[model samples]
Target: MKARRVLVALAMMAAALPVAATAETLTNDMVVALVQAGLGDDAVIAKIRASAGHYALSTDDLIALKKRGVPGPVIAAMIESGSQGAVSAKAAFSADSPDPLAPHPSGLYLLSGPRMVRIDPTTSNQSKTGGILGYAFTGGIASLSIKAVIPNVTARVRTKHGRPTFYFYFDEATRGLSQAGSPSLWLSGPASAITSPNEFTLIRFDVKKDRRETRVGSMNLAGAKAGVMDRDRIAFDYEQVTPGVFKVMPKADLTAGEYGFLYSVSAGAGPGMWGNGTGSARIFDFAVHP
Candidate 1:
């Protein structure tokens, strides 16, 4: 009788165990298989929701899903499900609470810096195209000026995982171009001097559908002392934390997407504000992982 009781107890325990304990974790291939097996988005999402395991997704995984005719919303559901093992997206970034990824002023340097290190031609083989301008005064009566500039270039960098604040460190070289004089001086100074903290704006870069990009929001400088800022333009709040160190605080948590900073020549009044460049902007691209 005692032996029979022990056997029954063991059998009950086994029955209570979840079947998924022996099942494989979720994967892109598994999702594809399910879709091919005629499962709908609702069904797929339900399975993922009921499943228990971390989903390790890669760039290839996303591309594969798109290629396999998976709807973007469905793919987004998969990513959200994977990103938050159990927590919801809203819970992940609560509006009332301080962002867990918020950087400490002292610790900002550890995670923030210039993504594009201006390369010296002597140090690297990176091809560069740009030159200086010249002005000639003939007979001290009339003057001839020559202008030359390269097309805007982009730099790609990955965002520090989970960090919401962006830090920009200006070495002596960057400050001379962007910082130094007051905002009023920007118009009269060299084009290089057009780079101000307010000149920075966040943008979204879509890799799919012809690699198009768009501005994230319409931001403007509110508390600036001097500058030609438009309320209609997208801008960021900038502060000089130290001599050459600056931090840009976004209005809200950045959603999972590909984003970048645009350095606009029309950062002040508007297009052709500087009367130099054609209001073209330099972009520094980055990705926010889910």
Candidate 2:
């Protein structure tokens, strides 16, 4: 009778083996596959939170993870699991309330740092240089300054969870013309030139081993659509908080990896104006860790 009972208990334990084995063993590649399959951020995050495995992530792997659309929080979690030190939660950007020409605070920013950058006339022109003749006329040439606060910075910053907001400034004089329907309108007057206009978009960037970035995809924030540009990118929405202050936090969560707050300076209405026809865009690069 005792032997019969023992055999029954063993059978019961054996019956549950397949169920226990069904649980997924999480991995970076598996996460990417989940994202490609249209898993929601919350669901994917939950899987990551439940995972107790290790990852072999390198710089290329990190970049690839981002390109596959994993949110930063998830990546940070992965990094935390694979490495020793705690992943930093502090992130910030420069908000120069006073002088504008100083370095716009590039490089990796901690999530706990200031999340803003001030874009003004002086700082916007920080990189504007012309030939000797153009430099000779300081005031006239300077008017063509094309600097954006986070001027095309090529570095990554770690951000905290929830939504990410980007803040910047734009003068009233340059408003309402960044995306004019007809160039004739802004071109009508001498003072009527296109400016930054607080316009921005969220874009995915692919980072090579050398850290060289290539544009892989663009997100239509308003339309809520993601498209393939070159087998490399993801998409998200953004909102304009005010005239100059803009935010790029999408309703969906971001997977880990590198991204950009791509903003543009409007091409003024004339051939001699300070834009690159389609407008010259500047990249504010950042990374979202697990």
Candidate 3:
């Protein structure tokens, strides 16, 4: 009897809510109230999905929601709702903004002043697969390493900033602009294949007099694979600007040298084992000038 009365009062209150409040505005407090009013997880989740959920889902926020007796499933639904909302909001903002960081061609870009400078894709001219000597010296115990040698000592695209910011757009439209006339190559299928920035590596090339080199991967005598060595890899941080869009920045300031964003598709061997039934590799090369 009391539960019936509570439900009736809640319905009346909802009816009295302003159009904006009654429409797409579902808040954390309202969710707690609904759960307290004896709503099931499905009911709460349905409400969340139907409304624009303004949920504070930080660690502390989640903990508070759990403490308030919100069901685990409801919490999970809240998270999904929050993620969808964020992506939608980001897409809307990107679509409206005239900023250089807004959605553009699907490729790597460096932000220079008010303009976005596209980084052209290039392939390694030569590959040196060594570590065989090391393996022999170690009695087939050491791993075999492969280094990709790009023909030019210097890259055409140069930036004065030591730690430049880069943007990546993986939209299906304008996919050919970044692939160096090979759109069917890297990430051809689903745009979701390379969702995270971790899929790409920031590599500082070993600048020789005539070429720049970096270790792509290594393989053991037994065909076990060890991906790109840590020595040549530079750490970076990234955040999703919108769906299929990301902003990347190096964790530490890069020293003036040749660098590139390297993405490779491994074909059973190791990364960058291009040609001869191996796989393919793509790099967006640039130089950080002092």
Model 3, C-alpha of 207: deviation from truth (Å): 1.7
Candidate 3 lDDT, 1-290, residue by residue in tens:
99999999999888887754656678889999999999788898898888777888889999999999998999999999887765554444332233644546456778776677778778765676677788888876798777777878999988888889887767543331232233422355432476566788789888888988887777665765545677767999998777667789999899998999887634435443444424445688999997
Clashes of 3: 0
What's the residue-level lDDT of 158 in candidate 1? 46
Off by over 4 Å in 1: 1-155, 160-163, 171-191, 215-235, 265-279
- Cα deviation at 42, candidate 2, in Å, is 70
| Candidate 3, position 185, lDDT | 29
Local accuracy of candidate 1 as per-residue lDDT tens digits, 104-223:
111112233423221111111111111222112233223222111222232243455544455554332232122212132223423345434565556554443424334222211221
What TM-score would every model get versus the actual structure? 0.31, 0.31, 0.55
Candidate 2, RMSD to the unseen true structure? 22.4
Q: What is the lDDT of residue 127 in candidate 1?
A: 16
lDDT tens digits, residue span 1-290, model 2: 99999999999999999998887667888888877788877787777777654565888989989987887877887776654322111121233322222122321112334334322211122222223344346534322222223234334355655355444333332232222221222233322333332334555544445443433212221221112232343444544544433334555677766666554333434453333322333455666665
Q: How much does each candidate deviate from the true structure in C-alpha RMSD?
A: 19.6, 22.4, 13.2
Ranking by lDDT: 3, 2, 1
